[model samples]
Target chain A: MEDPRNRQYTNDEITVFWKPAKCVHATTCFRELIEVFNPGRRPWVDMSAASTQRIIEVTDKCPTDAIVWKYNKDLSENELQASTSTSEEVNPETLSTDPETKPAKVTIMKDGPIVVEGEFKVIDSNGNELKSMIMTSFCRCGGSHSMPYCDGRHRKIGFNDKK
Target chain B: MKEKSAQFRVIENKSLEVSGSFEIFNAKGELLKSEGPIYLCRCGLSENKPFCDGKHKNSGFTG
Candidate 1:
């Protein structure tokens, strides 16, 4: 059975498949190629932002098989035709926002700050705005000495989140 | 319904402010940070770990 949740995108040379269920939010895609894998952008995958080679390289780095790619030449005729038709019809606005606004998913790094995603607001202790970031890390180690934001001190202090 | 983007505010010498649709999990994958308006320690001096405990004031943490 076909899962409607699975999506794919392609340029003239290659096709990129997205399996959201497998995503661990490791952020490798966006961090490596924000121009193409910007989570802030709808559809979140812009195949045209980079060359097919670069896209393939980054896609391979995905820790999970959440994202995968294949050469257009390798796809069957039916797949090639589907790629073209669907690629052109993509509308950024049609993409889901925050998976229905449930809440931002926060992942605490093994030795780093907390990585926050989705919809949320961060205010200072006194109620001032520092910066609104789509994805940001907050200090968890008691050694940051910064208080709220991470200063990359976790690594220095050997702060293990596993504890 | 559409979800709004999350917002984060950094304090001058205190914790970072976070609100809106978000969740905070600990290193063990536990939900240590609460949703809603929560303050996370930046100075790393909070007795509560992630939450601000005002230790920065006594420690004189400039960051």
Candidate 2:
């Protein structure tokens, strides 16, 4: 069966897999290499954006198995079958890339970072514009050295949010 | 014409201030806030969650 949350991206030399269920939202992938793992783009993982080696390096930084990759020649038969399958239901609401997408998206991931996307500006408490980004991950664990931005410290600290 | 950029403000070591056109939702895909100028907890000490509750002082939470 097709898993809606399992996404795969390819670029001849390699194929990247994204398992949302396993994601700890470390923010490592995007923060280190937004060119390839851009959350603002639909099918967020764009393998073509970087070299196979660079992609592999960033994917390796993930603290969880949320993102994985393999050489196209090394893919197992089952993986190949799953990658080629396109039977999942298409839900427009879950579509990540609609040009006219909403003003901002704040997704509080379970045990992960708060993923924010869309055009927006970040201001300091003193009314200074710190940044204007299309997408970013905010640390909810409060253990990140990057301040508001997550640095994958939640996993190390085993931070848990009360339900 | 080009539009203005959204504003996000960091309140020292306490919280993040987001303003301008934006919408916020929790992990369950529930809509929480859709308006601009919202305070998000940065110190992770908020009892109210996501939003700042001014608990950073006691928590000794720093960036």
Candidate 3:
């Protein structure tokens, strides 16, 4: 079983496992706490960047269990095996290639960008097809120089939903 | 019901033109929009919220 994408990070108190294939770019981890789960940094996740309690709080917010954490002592045999063997559990995503399933899902993140996930097509104002994607985040605070796509400008600008 | 396709058009820094059969939920999991051909605010200054109300004009809201 060749699992090159499986990455594990530890901080003596807990271990965080990452499954890249399961990531839907929900941005919860980075949006909530970027110090630990920065996508820009190589190896991408730094468990030592934050406290174990803070890391757990952000990791648990992942919509898909792409990133999961377990206490050093609480990890069961199966969890340890999870790092080496591919689990038989299948995560169902609406973005599957099934054309007859349903419409894509649009979810607004709390005080963050709008996360659009599932099968969908994007077109420019000129009606040109931009790119088809299963998951993407759109800027809601209208500060992204990248236009519609989120470039994490909302956080820099301190975008607030209420006031 | 027949399957519906989702389409999003970036309307030149004004708004996002979204169409097709879909449901939109806010951060609180509340249904925001669930219909067709709606212009969502892109300038972050919509008084009406989420939906566009032509506020992009004069807001210096460049892409």
For each candidate in turn, the TM-score is 0.49, 0.58, 0.69
**Candidate lDDT (C-alpha), each:** 0.65, 0.71, 0.74
Cand. 1: chain B TM-score: 0.82
Candidates arranged by TM-score, highest first: 3, 2, 1
DockQ of 3: 0.70
Q: Which 10-residue window in model 2 chain A sums to the lowest lDDT?
A: A89-98
lDDT of 1 by residue, B1-63 (tens): 665555677777666666766677765777765555777666656666666778779777665
Can you write out model 3's per-residue Cα lDDT over A69-140, one digit (the tens) per residue? 888788878666665544333221222444465777888787777677666788988999975666666777
Tens digits of per-residue lDDT for model 3, B1-63: 765678888898698888886789988888888787888877888877677899889888887
Q: Which model scores highest in lDDT?
A: 3
B1-63: candidate 2 lDDT, tens digit per residue: 444545677677787777776778787889998776778777666777777778787777877
In model 3 chain A, the worst 10-residue window by lDDT is A86-95
Better of 1 and 2 by TM-score: 2
1 or 3: which has the higher DockQ? 3
Give the poorly placed runs of model 2, Cα more than 4 Å off. A1-68, A72-101, B1-5
